[model samples]
Target: MAYRRTPAVQARLDAQREAVLQAAVVLLAERGYGGCSMAAVAERAGIATGSMYRHFSGKSELAVELFRTVVGREVAAVTEAARRESTPQRRLAAAVETFAARALRAPRLAYALLAEPADPVVDAERLVFRRAFRDLFAEQIADAVAAGEIPPQNAELTGAALVGAVGEALVGPLAAGGRHPDEVIPALVSFTLRALGGSHDSDA
Candidate 1:
């Protein structure tokens, strides 16, 4: 006969799955992709190495899932910050600052997500999240252009450009364990504002 999972048993399994994912994230943040092996994750999760295969197919799948969960949360945070602002420039600035500030706060994880080399599966996820971030900026830029808050430009191109530029600028600091949030966020915000063709005197 085939076995079926009871509700209580399934809930416990779900919790264990979440625990495993969380352990992978912590390992990735501490040591990047290269250091986060299946054994390491299993050990960190307090599960036997072979037992990990019960929850995930292999390292690649676990890494990809970890990338999705963490990066998805980050993208949501910046998106929400931008959405809350009333103006295009303000929205852009909020997104930029929120992204930079949060990244600076978690330098190791930011570096892992933004710069570390990974398996093809995780790399694909990186591209998806990168585009997701760019799209958030693109939407705000399009709105700003329509409202004449900033000069008209190719919203798609500008949005992608901003994401690349800000991401590159943060790489060094994030790799070096980061600098003061106060210092990095304002600089990134000012740079993004200028790139968007807005005045420094205005709110970012």
Candidate 2:
């Protein structure tokens, strides 16, 4: 059924969609995806269960949209945070801190983004996001190599390794009960720098 709306109605609909996403995140965080229900999400959004069906067809679509919404925010924030840092190491560090801090700020959202799996749409969206971050790291590594700050290596390989390392290093700490992000970011930065053949000034 086509649910066309006036401009004002459209705005309200958009707002309702965001609320659904938020509610879905809460549900996924509190109860794993298998346990969450569309009716529950609708209730959380303060909308009737029937109204949510107008926006999302099923559990998969709702979860995918939530994945896109929450993880997209993290990816965008990380990209923005690392924009000023030129060195590959610093850029990698910025990326790590961005993920860690954001994860802590939204633990359930972070879990849904990193640890949990969504539908096929979510998987495709995640792959696109992962590649974007990989490209960003590759660019930084290229710059660092150009400046003679690091050993020469294939940018893609280097980027993949760093991205993997970042995920491995931060995921546990971010998810660890009672763990704070500020404490982990510096350690993460230092470790990644060393893994990248250490900085130029470190040996002196």
Candidate 3:
């Protein structure tokens, strides 16, 4: 006969799963992928090491899941910020600021997500978020071009360039765990606006 969990038992299991995932996130942020082993996560989560496999097949699966969770949250934030403003230029500025600001606020996590070398699975997951970010920029660029806010440009190429430029610029700062060093968001906003031929008169 098949067995079904009682409501109370299922709730406990759900809470345990959340605790395990949270523990993994903290460990990953604190020590990068290399330091976040299944045993370590289990220990941090106050569960038996063997139990981790019940939640995740292995370290790779856990790492990939964590990557998706973390990067997905970041992408949502950037998307929301980008769509908040009416003008495409303002939306682009907001996107840049939101992305940079989040990275600055959580340098360890940001560095781990953006710059740390990881297993191929996790690297592929990183690429997914990178593309998501590029797409956000592409949408704004297309809109701005249509509205005559910026000159005609290859939106895809330009979006990729922006993502690469922004990620590269933040790597060193993120590695050093610096917060809002020298008005990074403003400088980035100004630089991005200028690069896209958008007006830089308004502060981002």
Candidate 1 per-residue C-alpha lDDT over 1-204 given as tens digits, one digit per residue, 9 for 90 to 100: 899999999998899899999998898788888878989998999989998898889988888889999988898899899889888889889999889888888898999899887778877988897899889999999998999888999999999999999999999889878887777788888888888888672554
TM-score of model 1 (CA atoms): 0.94
Give the distance in Å from residue 77's predicted Cα in candidate 3 to where it truly belongs.
Answer: 1.5
Cα RMSD for predicted model 1: 1.5
Deviation from native of the Cα of residue 194 in model 2, angstroms: 1.7
TM-score of each: 0.94, 0.80, 0.92
Candidate 3 residues lying further than 4 Å off, grouped into runs, are: 1-8, 201-204
Model 2: lDDT to the true structure: 0.72
Model 2 per-residue lDDT tens digits across residues 1-204: 898779998898888888888888778677656546899998888899999987999887887777667667777888888886666567666776676677676665555555565567766766766677678778777777777777888877888787777766666764664177767766666676776775632331
**Model 1 pairs in collision:** none
Error of 2 at 144 (Å): 1.4
Model 1 bad stretches (over 4 Å): 201-204
- How do the residues 1-204 of candidate 3 rate in per-residue lDDT, one tens digit apiece? 899999999999889888988998899788888888999999999999998887799999999888888888899998898887888889989898999998888888888888898899988988898899999999999999999989999998999999999999999889878566667777888989999988883743
True-vs-predicted CA distance for residue 105, candidate 1, Å = 1.0
